[model samples]
Target: MHLSHPTPLQNIMESKTCSRRGILLPFNSYSSHKKDAQHCIFCDTTFPLRNFKGKAVCPTCSQNILKLFLEREVR
Candidate 1:
């Protein structure tokens, strides 16, 4: 089908990593029905939701995010 512009795959659906976003992150998406685990926002690292308070971000991603925030704060 012909179209003026096509939308990105990630922006078409809700992201599984974040709270709310019209983004479909395939790499971070899991087909399993296990509700105890989740994938990280930046990377596909599996983590427990209970420990992270429902946040799907892993330690590596968290550290990177922290570093970025600290750098921005420093600047």
Candidate 2:
């Protein structure tokens, strides 16, 4: 009996086609813009800002603010 391993070329091609999860898509539809990077108001972490919206806080803090608002509404 004989076993055959993939060649270096095959390995490279496979890596380019797939990620840690599954096959790579032709185009990344969810890709976000990288030009508007800014620091989060609350945590001060740098992240990409979205669209034309002016947000001082990052998404995490925004979600937290929403949660707080919902909690206050339920009370």
Tens digits of per-residue lDDT, candidate 1, 1-75, equal 776665676555534445864766566445565675567755677763223445677777675877756877898
State how far residue 18 of model 2 sits from its true place (Å).
30
Per-model TM-score versus the true fold: 0.31, 0.29
TM-score of 1: 0.31
lDDT of 2 by residue, 1-75 (tens): 544988889899998898676666686344353455567665676764332246566667676876756877999
Native-referenced Cα lDDT, model 1: 0.62
Give the poorly placed runs of model 2, Cα more than 4 Å off.
1-37, 50-53, 66-75
Total backbone clashes of model 2? 0
- Weakest ten-residue segment in model 2 by summed lDDT: 28-37
lDDT of each: 0.62, 0.65
